[model samples]
Target: MNDKRKKLFLLDIDGTVALGSELLPGAADFLQTVKENGGIFCFLTNNSSKAASDYVEQFRDWGIE
Candidate 1:
């Protein structure tokens, strides 16, 4: 028998993951760790000022896909 559990991490974008165009300290590391451990991390934002494409571009600038 095989036993494995899925891991999902729901994170905020503004203050938790980043501030403006900069990513907070250890944020990248934490995300990388999650990926390395076979976990998934998703971003959640309540701000409606920017479009989803804007965030995609921003994340690309930070070397995150």
Candidate 2:
């Protein structure tokens, strides 16, 4: 593996970040640590009923970026 290579983490929202409106423990810390270690991440969801902005708002509500 290339240690210099940048990493990208595609994280799921439901059950991963939260179980409804609540943010799971260590979720924010994990993401922040990844960022501090020079990693990038994005939130993914299977539900297409809501737009991307909706997810952004949800994250904001959870105090996640």
Candidate 3:
């Protein structure tokens, strides 16, 4: 029998993932690595300046989704 546990990463958007419209160095690679390792990552934000839809659009523009 084989046992493996799924991993989940909850990351912050600002500074952690990106600063403004730019993606931080290695952020993309880190996320890709998570997927490659059968892990799931979700973005988290404490800023309420933007709506969820706006973030979705921004993420798409950044090639995150």
Q: State the lDDT of candidate 3 residue by residue for 1-65, as single tens digits.
A: 57576689999999999998788999999988899998999999999999999999998887787
How close to the true structure is residue 8 of candidate 2, measured as C-alpha lDDT? Answer: 95
Model 3 — which ten-residue stretch has the worst lDDT?
1-10
TM-score of every candidate:
0.88, 0.82, 0.85
lDDT (Cα, tens digit) per residue for candidate 1, span 1-65: 57576589999999999999899999989888889989998999999999999999999899788
State which candidate, 1 or 3, has the greater lDDT. 1
TM-score of 2: 0.82
Quick one: best lDDT, which candidate?
1
Q: Spell out the clash pairs found in candidate 2.
A: none
Question: For residues 1-65, could you state the per-residue lDDT of candidate 2 as single tens digits?
Answer: 55976689988989997877788999989988888998999888998888899888988887777
Give the lowest summed-lDDT range of ten residues in model 1.
Answer: 1-10
Model 1: clashing residue pairs?
none
lDDT of each: 0.91, 0.86, 0.90
Clashing pairs in 3: none
